[model samples]
Target chain A: MNLARTTSTTKGKECEAVPSDGKPGAVGVDPEQLWLRPTEPRRGRRPSFSREAITAAAVTLADAEGLEVVTMRRVAAEVGAGVMSLYSYAPDKETLLELMVDHVSGELTVTDPPSGDWRADLKTVAHLQRAHMLRHPWLPAALTTRRVPGPNTLAFLEHVLAVLRPTGLDGAAKLEVFAQLTAFVAGHVGHEIAQAAVSRSPDRAAAEGRYLAAVAADGSHPELAEALSAPGRPLTPEATFTRFLNRLIDGLDTD
Target chain B: MNLARTTSTTKGKECEAVPSDGKPGAVGVDPEQLWLRPTEPRRGRRPSFSREAITAAAVTLADAEGLEVVTMRRVAAEVGAGVMSLYSYAPDKETLLELMVDHVSGELTVTDPPSGDWRADLKTVAHLQRAHMLRHPWLPAALTTRRVPGPNTLAFLEHVLAVLRPTGLDGAAKLEVFAQLTAFVAGHVGHEIAQAAVSRSPDRAAAEGRYLAAVAADGSHPELAEALSAPGRPLTPEATFTRFLNRLIDGLDTD
Candidate 1:
């Protein structure tokens, strides 16, 4: 039913579209149809399940498995619906992903207002985001694209904007800061999670160590060899995140 | 063949594996076999094509179309080989991806040595990476995983290590800096490319503007409303990148 036209009709929404993986022709979800419209089917008889149920199911699958396994058929099976029927709720996997992302963003509930120390407040914001992404590991990748902010995401964005109010940066600058901060956190957490997985597998970690040792011994990479030889105190992922976050946030110029 | 055993046997190589997509069980390519092993098939009569050709073809495909369209079968067809035969070179799409990422990295040729100003040098290193990722839009997603550094990637890494030598950061810190910088650039480019795509489509841009306007009008998103209303001097992607890069690099503490 002219899906392309329907999806292409909306743009410049809050969350950026999913990373296109360099696919230039990719179209993001229409915010109007996706967010503004009714959650249930308008014309058909009331179904036993709701869109929220479907989205929750998809999020569960992604959390347990990975984004790779959250297929339409798999998600349908989880919700006890036919694949075709699931189409009525989320036209495709992309739409389902949009739904899944927003569904999980519901957890980013910040009750306290900004503390007025913008940098300190922003650090807390990033920490909140990092923890949230780690809980729902699929989030960082899901966030790489343009996403229309669903109700939950909007609420979080509103809070972040309020936090930035003390900075006196223009509205656009505040928005840019939020987007960049989110991207930075996502990138850091994505790496941190992958590193954690490697650390979990002792065999893999040892193998990697040996592999690097061999490379260092090759003489061509003297700097690497020296770096490896005098390895300093190993920092935890949380420390690294804070270190980088401080650098990024502190470096932001209000002028 | 025991594929799992073969892949899990090697780790701690230079390039981190592809982003595990939060998949804990994901194993990276075996660096020894992938990088040190001969390019030609060891046993059988050497096939008509080389590993380099297969990787190049895959890269071309990914460049023209997104990473999603690059399948083993498609690559085989492009190289005029059977899909089964291609497996001898790259056992799976993951391995092929490892190959392709390193292959494109060959383009990141840095002729000058570190300029003594480690921050400036690191900034240059990041800018080079930003441009490289932009050229291969799929790189950001691919770099999300742990990858073994093949010869090309190793060559580039060696250059970066030299640049970091001035910082007096321990070898581990140097390595961490490089990884973080790469992730930051990938994250930025991924978002930049997606935003560019939206900008290219006027219809989509307008729809997004309308969607956000509606949200801003909803009273609940006052901060979003103000931010949208006064989006300051629209910054170019390059300027935004440079701004963020400065903050990140300048704020990096050598102590």
Candidate 2:
């Protein structure tokens, strides 16, 4: 929505106070309305309710109890406000998630600026994207982002694009490369995080372990069994991120 | 789980007799149990519930209702059986899902197997992987597969490793490449599927239309905006998938 105008209910006679029934909600200058920050808030004061506060609360709930528990009323209550008040900022739970997506996206650092080497540059960018998603595992489930690339996301895309520019690929190819590269990194990280959550369940993990032992008992799939048994090198998003980047770069730029 | 020792209650029934229970539970078969037919009161039977049947039912649920809804009770309902009885075949829902994962992975076909041309071979394998995930969007979400690859998954990996065989990369390097490639392909498909789901949402589609209108108003972030608005080509998983595979291949393989 129109994000330019933010409202901050007046500070009243008591400092550090927010009026429940006061003026328009606190909004900020974030025009994308990406974080669902209030539309009109003056400096040095807290709004009665805010998108950031709600999302933070939701994130906490999700991290602790899993995503299924992060409902609208629950998040609203967490923020010490009514569902209606929370709605004033997030409008709906899905919208609140979108805001959360942008909020988490903002945590990634673009760089002092992207370096010029397309290969090195891309590796760096991939690592950062992985790091961003890892910090907010809830983000992987928010796979379908609308065309609204928030400020932070815009920056991330720009930085990657900048790195690719020096590689000598034209806009169309570059766009395709960038899109594929990102999809790989994002998809990979999402799998890892979600899998970890599922595996963390004792019943599930135990069952999986037994199944593995049973299946491998006959050694029918030796390569497979060895793979299953290997104390494998742990792959964070960064390493997998880099490896995929290499694969993509190696696959592209025959020039 | 005593997988091999499992038995199907459908055996030993007479050909023309009506089912005794009238509850219409699936005649589940643990073929490993070798209880091909029950004794005494054998009757005519409907199709039996194998792990594959349960897995297919689970996949169908996930495809239609999203992953969260694919619970044990729901899957049992779909299979026309009691929830507790599912443990005989699936042990737990996670194992059931693992069965589903392997079952779905079984759908992938790498026809020529892997060739010495690692780049070309990997490219071929990559496309097959992409196609499989694309067909089943819920797959990438649940394919947690940590150490032991399932039967179908292991075959796929074995095939992938064979492709890397000619790359002259060592075990660790080959493993990394394999992991990276799978992650990349899986991750990319995950995004595409997630986005497809998003576009399917009326509210999101409406919000997106609004977001696009806003973007048009601002007339900034030209590349981002262009990428969003351009009608250059159909936005399909196939197009992006191929592009990404090429990019990764180009980025790797200095040989």
Candidate 3:
């Protein structure tokens, strides 16, 4: 995460991929290389591995280990291919990342057409995204870096656009809305994941609860204390997601 | 980056930190150890550095470089102290991260009292947060981990709670609202930072534009093509942030 990579109008998180040389790559990928370039299979004798198989292996690795461990060598080894051979399939770790992203995105099957109630449909979209990210725990992080939608991701985006069709937003606003919604879901889910981990330990949860209690007892934090003491609805993760998602999608104004 | 750590209620992204010993620390930190634990000044001599100084040095390193480089050794070196001495200030990188978060959070000063219009004031808070993240690009990543608020973070949270006071929300909901808003801002700014880096490279931007055009040209993605072709408002980052923030805060329901 070389936060120092700066240019005019710069926005977003730094690239997650660390180069083998142990240096951060320039903040973003070459679009032509990532999107425009076509993958060609070897024309010689039949290749031992397919890009799909390689990408699946990489996804499995990330799903099992984490994104950082999805190096070409490990991915190639997982697929029983030579390290050099993997390049024909994924060129570089960054490219593999693109593949890994698209691979998991296939799970987001938009079987139901948009219900035409765009807000409800958008809520469903958020729910699906939350579930999808839950399944692929690395997804929220993967999406944070600069990504070009592959076929699967583009398909999902198309579905979201369809859901927003009634909003009468211009093409760009629709795109922006989709991007915003996805970011909101990812952010919520990421925090949810972290907090869930903390809650798993009774000691830690108790400690946090106690700490909040103590803070509330202290006179300076009257608002915080009052809030904690107030009776509240059960904030199951799903319920929390629904509340926030409604605030976002229902409040959206095409104008 | 450990995407694999799972439990019964496992939902989203995994832990960002990997323990050196290849074991997950018993979930979360004890609140007492984190907040209430007193730092005993070394007996031998007057300490040359304050906790504030060490945290500031770490924040500087993260701001200039990135979060990955703000190690104990490097932070100590930056502060002109021995590596061992740094531990007296920050027991570990996690503690240092908590400190770094609070340190940068000091910038979120709420000088103006909350306006009677809570929605508008909440928008201001979001705007302040977005600007803060832009200044410290490392903040979004830092926020993803489980953080215990230090003095600075709590002060800001207290201000947010005060802003939400008119909403008639009990204490927990106010806290939830604050957390949700912060996460949203961090998520948006993180993406904004990433996108800004991509826009810096005209070649890459053009390639992305062209690729989208080609995708839109293809018959399969009609909604996508239509959306892309539509004349849209100029999406300046600030404008985008305001648009989304309004949807979130305005749609917020206290009941």
Top candidate on DockQ is 1
- Tens digits of per-residue lDDT for model 2 on A1-255? 343223323211222221222111111112234422344544564557655677678877766665667787788788889776765565446556665665666676465665666777777777777776676655555543333456556556756666766665555556666666666666677656645643555444565556655665665545445555653555554555565566666556624
* Candidate 3, A125-215: lDDT as tens digits: 8899999988877787777676878778888999999988888989878888888888898899878877776777666678778877776
What's the distance in Å from true for residue A63, model 3? Answer: 3.0
Highest TM-score: give the candidate number: 1
User: If scored against the real structure, what TM-score would every candidate get?
Assistant: 0.90, 0.69, 0.85
The regions of model 3 sitting more than 4 angstroms off are A1-26, A39-41, A44-46, A65-77, A81-88, B1-29, B68-74, B82-85
Candidate 1 C-alpha lDDT tens digits along B1-255: 111212121222433544344464366765655565433334545456667788899999998897888998899999999987677666567888988998899899899988998899989989999988888888888877777677678778889989888788887788888878888888888888878878887767887888789889877788999999988888788998999999999999888
- Candidate 1 deviant stretches above 4 angstroms: A1-22, A39-43, B1-25, B38-43
Error of 2 at B64 (Å): 4.7
lDDT of 3: 0.73
Q: Rank the candidates by lDDT, best first.
A: 1, 3, 2
